[model samples]
Target: MQSNHKKRICIVTRSLSEGGADRVASLQSILLNNLGYQVFIVTILNSVSYPYKGELFNLGAIKEKNDTILGRFNRLLLLRKFLKSKKIDIVVDHRVRKKPFSEYIISALVYPKKTIYVVHNHAIDLYFPPFKWLTKLVYKKSKAIVSVSGKIQNLIFKKYGFRHLETIYNPVDLDYIDKQKIESVTIESPYVFWYGRFEDEQKNLSLLVDSYNDSKLKSQGVKLVLMGNGKDKDKILSKVGELGLTDTIVVLPFSSNPFPYIFNSKFTVLSSRFEGFPMTVLESLACGIPVVSVRYDNYEDGVLKHKHNGVLVENHNSGALAKGLNLLVGDEKLYLSCCENARKSIESFSMEAIALQWKNLIEK
Candidate 1:
């Protein structure tokens, strides 16, 4: 049933395209809309790659037309007007608030009292200002600060001591994923998949290549598929070429629906140096495909239960990652076991479960 009074909500985000957090923001719009709330998505950038359900206010388009200082100010003014005109009861911000002054203007002038800031990374500095006082002031008028994981929440509390903090795991739309996973892809090889932005610094695609090269999967006729676009696409491609595994390692463009690829793969892998609850891992598991990831300290227990649903290897160790990858590929019994456990393991992160949490937050 819908809430007694249908509230209007505006999800503030960088873009509806790319990035895990942006995807979460898009999903929230869908969830809220389903719950009978009027949802408006306000994106700072014009990049719209992900699928969403809501009225979108693309402020970037206006900025692009003028591309002046006054245009930027006008965009802010227009944003405030949009919220006022829509009578937005709640503002869920999912953007990285790096600029303190800009955030100050936003929090103090534009956003409503019930605004909730989301911290999407272990690197809290990206979401919260470097200065504690500024960080507190920027979000002081807001209702709560939401971190995507428990570890991220603790880190924020420990560092900045923000009282109004909450942890909401990124939700996976299993229904949609299940539907998409059933769709056919042309690839015939039994390949392991890694899909996301090709940024080497954060994603550590170098580690992914090195580990894959060192693994036995290549010799066993299993190809490595790297999917998605980013700043380091050329660098990653060059690395793959240097290894002379281009034939075995295929690079594909970003797909709005990656579930089909995930569904067809042997298993998915994550070799990130750091992450804040990667959606790829959750989505793969939801697709009934097990994951192999180098252990990042902040990863939630339910996301990867080591031998239960996915393999979590030693942090930053390519050798350990390779072994973990090989372990799943070589041991047919264990791979099957992990695959069987994968979908059920992430039940807590389902849309219904996470949406309930959001509902309570919004209602209260």
Candidate 2:
């Protein structure tokens, strides 16, 4: 909180590319930069598609060139030296800490006491390894562990008994959305949208296809637009073709600026098996587009309101999701009401409000 103290913060994550957690890191860089902080980003991977306002240190380039054991060790040494050279005041780490030994080294040698680990999924082991003692040993020394949902916060506590954990939902970058939403798109037909990787396990891409096939939206001439890339693209396309809904279902690659498409869509849908707090859902609501998402256990608590802002399908089954799609698109009055309430529903999650929480956390 002291003005005399330099606000030099650096974010450590996988990449500033296509992923919900990665996108949040990119937004944080912009938010911190706008607040007059000296911001820097250190991406473990070289992939970068999202726009960010900070200097980037791409460690992935080194690993790409030489992926030997010696090269990996060198990357670790260089990461530590890079942080020290920048004299980073705070480190907001968004990387998935899967390997226990690597995390131990990073926690013991690389990161400082001001580091904050952000958990972005319900799969707690992805962020904290399965070993409870090791998880506590590495993470307990940090400033705090932040989860994007209250459910994840509780899971962390119940699983690991960490008292320093807190929940900070993903903030929607309204200013950025305002600028991006106005970009022109060539799509003519009104479509329901879903954008993310084509992975079938986590994102449940087949559920999206099956539900769309069963929904009346296609019969009523509302198209389904899917935007993203992954391993299951061919499988998803094949399923769509088999169902004879290929023409009705439009599949496109991921877009860095997807707001224009989202802004013009009738609504958005999320069928993910689980998520911490998806950026797409927040971005959809921020774009004044209501979302119809399949609810996962203990998730969607704060973000999705059942009928006020969006429809939360009671179950993850394809039939339930199909019914939800029909209800939201079938009932004109409900659809319009949700659309009208969408933007305001997420006002509390604006970048400024969430940034204030980050500022408080850093100062306190």
How far is 280's C-alpha from truth in model 2 (Å)? 0.8
TM-score of 1: 0.97
* Model 2 misplaced stretches (Cα beyond 4 Å): 1-4
Residue 49, model 2, lDDT: 94
TM-score list, all predictions: 0.97, 0.96
lDDT for each residue of candidate 1 in 219-242, tens digit (9 for 90 to 100): 999999988989999999999999
lDDT against the true structure, per candidate, is 0.88, 0.87
lDDT computed for candidate 1: 0.88
Model 1 lDDT, residue 175, Cα: 88
Candidate achieving the largest lDDT: 1
